[model samples]
Target: MWRDEAATWQVAQRSTAEIWHLLANVDVVHGLYYLLMHVLFTCFGPGTTTLRLPSVLATAVAAACVAVIGRRVAGSWAGLAAGLAFGLLPAVQFHLQEGRSYALVAAGAAISTLFLTTVLQRPARTRHWAAYSTTVLLTGLLHWLSLMILAAHLATLLWTRAGRAVLARWAAAAGCAVAGVLPLIVFSRGQSVQVAWIPPLTWHMLIGPAVLLAIGGTCALPDRPRAGRLSAATVGLPLLAVPQLGLIALSLLQPVFLDRYVLYSMLGLALLIGAAVGAAVRAARPRFPTASRWILPVTLAVAMSALLPQSLATRSPASRVDDVLAIASDIRHLKRPGNAVLFVPPLRRDVKSLTPDAFAGLRDIALAVPPEKSGTLRGVETAPDRIRAALLAEQRVLLVTDASPGARPARGARDRMKTAVLHRYFVPVADEQTRGRRVIVYERRSTPR
Candidate 1:
């Protein structure tokens, strides 16, 4: 498990009351997902499989929804190709088995889109509108960022010129969903400090979305899409382009442009690819009747073969920045009896919180309150003076921190004090660095009599 998944594990282990209390202070955006994981952990008991199974299933559901939408807008062959394509995309593969809300949010986006396609194709009914509203509400509850999909859907409506009735009904349903999640949106804003670590947007950050749009545009060209038509290009182009462009616009103000936030956009790209394939097969059928039948299957096989290496790499521990599980094992091995531990930046405390068994015999010198009791992700720490005094009293202190390249100098007063006192009074006995984590053992020097 990586740090983010480790967070899910630690939070999900908390009691319902504790989880609710924790949300009151931070991570309210993930409150619903954390609660859902809480129930799963309660029943299944905590393990890697229990933590990640829901995401795997949710991703499968997203792929199935893409296939259904493709079939409706294009054809059976397009549906098969699109569904297969959804599973093969690198971003989708990364989060397919992650223990995070984003996968489930992607599934919800696909389901809501499927419903919208149904309503637009058939006569818009109250039941269909209600289903769309309810799905949108649930998806927003999972992560409000997904509510951006409504913008993509709106662009689809406008592109198709679906008439005033469809537009007004869509407005009503979307209005209801937005109102339902409005409180969460407002409350989560107060806790926006959680995202303060996200760096300012840069030119390099724009490259990924640019490449995606270029590919989607390439696929869309073959469709020769026209307005007022319910086709893949009309649906897929907006779904692919709108959210990404909207996110870029928003990032100019607040810098919240993580790709996982819009992973559902890949559904649009897959649809366009499927539509292009369907178009090719149709154009070639009369000229090469027997060979045309094999185009999609052959294309799919080639895609799978090309992506096999990346798919395997995504499943490996090396793909993530750091492994909490690995670091915990290192702590267990490096620790001696009665050693005191300190985590720089305090957030590194997650390793201990997630795998307390590894830290059972060690003392957390700076922690004033445990996370569950404190109602925070990272527990409250003592003041710098107290932490320094505690460091002075200890014979051996283990400093757990980010290894080089990932490491940043201590910025907080308490963290700086720990570093200063350790250097002044102690000598390094042992240092172990592995997989983006470092543990240094410092033994106090003898004072001359």
Candidate 2:
């Protein structure tokens, strides 16, 4: 497991009351997902399969929704193409097995879009609007960033030039959904510091969206869809463009432009690609009717072939930034009884929390409280002077830190103090670095007073 997955594993292992308390102080946005995982772990016992099964199922549902929407707007061939394409997208594949809520959010977005497509084709019944509103509300609860889909849907309505009844009903349904999630939005604002690590937007960030829009726009061109039509261009284009552009605009004020936040947008891209395939099939039927049937399968086969390597890579441990399990194994092998342990940035304590057995018989010299009791992901730590004093007393210490040699220097007094004391008083006895983490054994200098 990587750091984020390790976080889910450890947090979900906490008791219900402990999770509730943790949410009160941090990670409120993931409260529902963590609770859901907690239940799964309770029933099935915590393991990789239990941790990631929901995401796999959710991704399947999202792909199915894409296929259904594509069939409604384009044709059966389009539906098959879109569904297959959705699963093949690099972004979709990356989160397909993640233990995060984003995949569920993507599934919810696709369901909401499917409902909207149905309502647009038929008269907007009260039940349809209710289902739409409920889906939106649930998706927003999963992750408020998904509420960006609401803007994309509004653009769809405008592009289609829906009657006042449709527009008014959409407004009412969207209003209910927004109102339901508004409290979560209000509460999660207090934890905004969780996103402080996101870097400021730059010109290069635009390249990905621009490339996606170009491809979606190209696929849309073949449709010749009118403004007031319920076609791929009218629905798919806005779904793909609005959320990405909206995120860029929002990043002007805050740096929240992670593409996974808008992973649902890939559904739109898939729909457009399917429509383009449908158009090609129609045009080719007149000339080579028998061979035209082979078009979609042939296209899918080529795509699968092209993406096979990347897909395999995503399934590997190297895909993530670091592997917490590997780091824990090293700690387990290198540690001795009563050895003092220190995590340079402290957040590296996740390794211990996720696999405590690996850290058995070791003392966390800097921790003042455990994570569950402290209601923090990383437990509270002692002051710099106390940590320095503790380090001075220990003959041997184990340091688990990031592997990057050029990582940012310690900024806080506590972290700086740890670094200074280690350099001045300790000598490296043994060191092993793997999987983006380093485990080092250090001993006090021989001539030290």
Cα misplacement distance, residue 239 of candidate 2 (Å): 0.8
RMSD of each: 1.5, 1.2
Name the Cα RMSD for model 1.
1.5
lDDT of 2 by residue, 1-449 (tens): 88888879988999999999999998999888899999999999999999999999999999999999999998888888889999999999999898888899999999999999999999778999999999999999888989989999998998899989999999999999999999999999999998998899999999999999999999999889898888988889998999899899999999988998899999899999999998899889999998999999899999999999999999988898888878777888899999999997888899888888999999999999999899888899999999999999999999988888635677689999988888889999999888878898999997753
Residue pairs with clashing backbones, model 2: none
Off by over 4 Å in 1: 447-449
Q: How does residue 244 of candidate 1 score in lDDT?
A: 90
Clashing pairs in 1: none
Q: Output the TM-score of candidate 1.
A: 0.98
Cα-lDDT of candidate 2: 0.91
